[model samples]
Target: MSPSSRTPSGATEASDTPSEADETPALATIGEFGLIERVTRDRVQPPATLLGPGDDAAVVAQPDGRAVACVDVLVEGVHFRLDWSAPEDVGRKAVAANLADVAAMGAVPTGLLVGLAAPRDTPVETLEGLATGMWTEAEVVGVGLVGGDVASSPTLVVSVTALGSLEGRAPVTRDGARPGDVVAVCGRIGWAAAGLAVLTRGFRAPGVLVDAHRVPTPPYAAGPAAAHAGATAMIDVSDGLLADLGHVAADSGVRIELRRDAFAVPDRLAEVAPALGVDPIDWMLTGGEDHALAATFPAGTTLPAGFVEVGAVVEGEGVVVDGEPYAGAPGWEHFT
Candidate 1:
């Protein structure tokens, strides 16, 4: 199930105790701390991090008194592939996806906790590349990889827990949208889906669409901006626009009507669609992973910078494009 298709639930946590072993031939020779030391080198610390790496646990400053947190897991061959993405790209993309969730809540990201489980034979250099990728993306927004853990497993799995502060603003969840609200979006969409399609087909053309698949650039600032502008509800376009918007509609109990004329397919996507034999607009509506922010504002309210109005919230449920229900493949689903 996708995050958008789930109901609220809670669970208890079990304490984790590390297993001890002697004389292991795996992990490319150096011990766990050695690997940690290698990756932790030269990493910049975020302002929100009170106590960074090497502590028993990290202490982050949440000035708002409320912390907005979300965790994401990326498994090799499931969420990412070594053949498809460079090690660094994988790390950067992992952080970007989770960071988008923070932004979706209309909060400013503060710190990140990365957890990596890889095959025992994994190279430390490969892991360092991944760390470099993580720090590169985190530094882009003036944050750091404050804390994380490295473990041995049969496959590579990257998990990230992002922390953000709302700065006293109310969180804009999918449930807050209401009738007569204006729908808007900030940042690029469909580029990642189009890029992935091109890559899967073995097209090596260098373009913005292609790069997007490797490293998604989420509109990090738009989250806080929307909150300051009084956005009613918001979500990140990790899944397709329609699918994510469906969450807002279902939760808010309002219909969202999207205007086709309000948006246009990017030239880069249109340029690649012919060779791939698929409509670029399909990617726009259904393709996700661009990490763009989708929000609903009250009618006649001035929108935040970078947000463009795309639709309106109405009395009903579900989403529509061009005055009718969208009959396309919904969005990214975890299981078939």
Candidate 2:
């Protein structure tokens, strides 16, 4: 930063931006422009993204006439760890979390913009790996990287902004569920949490659980599919399912009652949970970061594939399991 931009107390004197003194230093090795070039290099822009990187700003066509935009940020040590999560996993997880929001809105994620803030010491190859991961994951969902910013920070901070189109469908929000709506979930829950538990305990768990913690595969098509199937409300389970569902209940002024027996715990978790001496139900109900989709469809509506009934919207408030209050905290918190 310029001297004028520095704080009066000299607190900002330790700049995270690379210094010119070391020509071979971290980011200075590639420089800002070079880093941008490396990340955007070989990226194929989709038709919706009329213009991509290498411009003042990207221009994405909103064919549906309304753009669905959402952003999420992951902080190193807080959201992820370089020691445990590879650079690629960090990039992919960031993309998945943001895209899940677009899906939650009942929209098709047409493109993504990644805003990365990292310490200058961060290796250039690491950032490139991150870029490659972003592109790979975006391609999985048929979108491309549009544009974003790279900046300096004390630690790695990944921020992804996903742009989507609703195709004339109404944006699904938390407040639309009615008393009789059937609650269904697509994707999964608890795996990430279980993976986290394993990580925290420093014990080896199943590879799938470890992978779940590293990179979540949100059901990208489920959001639009549910919307097309006439879902009344929807949300992405970045937080725990119970926590996120509580938002739906509060917004819709209806109680969401989940039947524990109905939750489809992934088969792998059966043995894994037993070994860990932890109830899989705990993770199923309160595990966050899975990026699953929980939605409410009209009662008796033929549920689409991948969506399994978990509960119902009833006349009341908050969320409950088997008609009783859940004893644990509902979900994850940001900036707590």
Candidate 3:
């Protein structure tokens, strides 16, 4: 007969208030459809998004009648850890990786589609945080999360598909680099590796490096700008500069020789690397996930904004540092 247990009609009612321990319900509590409703609600779509979530599929406009697309997948233990990063950070990193790929192709991003797999016991708030982070990164390039799907699984997995427009330009692919082309890069290179080293060593005092590992700040606009400026070949440094440049070399049948002194160690990396007993140059050479753009231009071609000369394409094969193979591991590779 207590008022707390009574409805407006004054009839007896079950308690609607949840205990403090159960305040945030698990995914099972809301069910799949409910979770979708929570994440998709109130989301704004860009003009390119013809139809967003709630439908069987999404329709995005391709202004130039050609679309560029790429996908990246992140698994819980392999790609990230909840204890090491917030859910939002993981979300941003996932979307950023795919978006970087679209940009590397010399296109402007239009929309994103995500696929999520997480345990049923996961908290609903975590998923919402993920969605929020995805939207945040998408808006950086003025795009939207057009569609996605969710499923039950033992481990959390995020797969993002980024679609883009070529805008009447041919894609700057890996095979376009020619001998005598100058090589250049357009963003931070070794910061993420330094951050990962710090995180692995049980310290986070230098937060800048740690944050880079969580959310990559790619130079999105530089992609199309490089294309307009007549870049020959381009690739995002997701798997270290040397390894990714090797892809361009092999595809174009040329050798990339880099000047060792071209990469002056940043002051922050120089200060922190000694404490971790690692060389900053190794990070610059082998670090992955920075998502910086590396491209080749004809000799004497004025480099685009934010780009600096680092090397040159030559009449040979594979990537070399100072005319020799790099001593450290090239980059990240699965199933070695």
Specify the highest-lDDT model's number.
3
Candidates in order have lDDT scores of 0.83, 0.84, 0.86
TM-score per candidate, in order? 0.90, 0.91, 0.92
RMSD to true structure for each model, in Å: 6.8, 3.7, 7.7
The order of the candidates by TM-score, greatest first, is 3, 2, 1
Model 2 off-target regions past 4 Å?
1-25, 329-336
Shift of residue 266 alpha carbon in model 1, Å: 1.0
Clashing pairs in 3: none
Model 1 spans > 4 angstroms off: 1-26, 330-336
Model 2's C-alpha root-mean-square deviation from the true structure amounts to 3.7
Ten-residue region with minimum lDDT total, candidate 2: 1-10
Better of 1 and 3 by TM-score: 3
lDDT of 2 by residue, 244-306 (tens): 888888889899999999986779887788878888989988898999999999999999889
Q: List model 3 lDDT by residue over 1-336, tens digit each.
A: 001212426321122322234677766667566777888789888999998887778899999998999999999999998888898999999999988898899999999998887776788899898888999999999999988877666788999999999899999999999999999999989999999899998997599999999889999999999999999999999989988998899889899999989997889899999998888999998898999999999999999999989999999898888988877754544202
Superposed Cα RMSD, model 3: 7.7
The TM-score that candidate 1 achieves is: 0.90
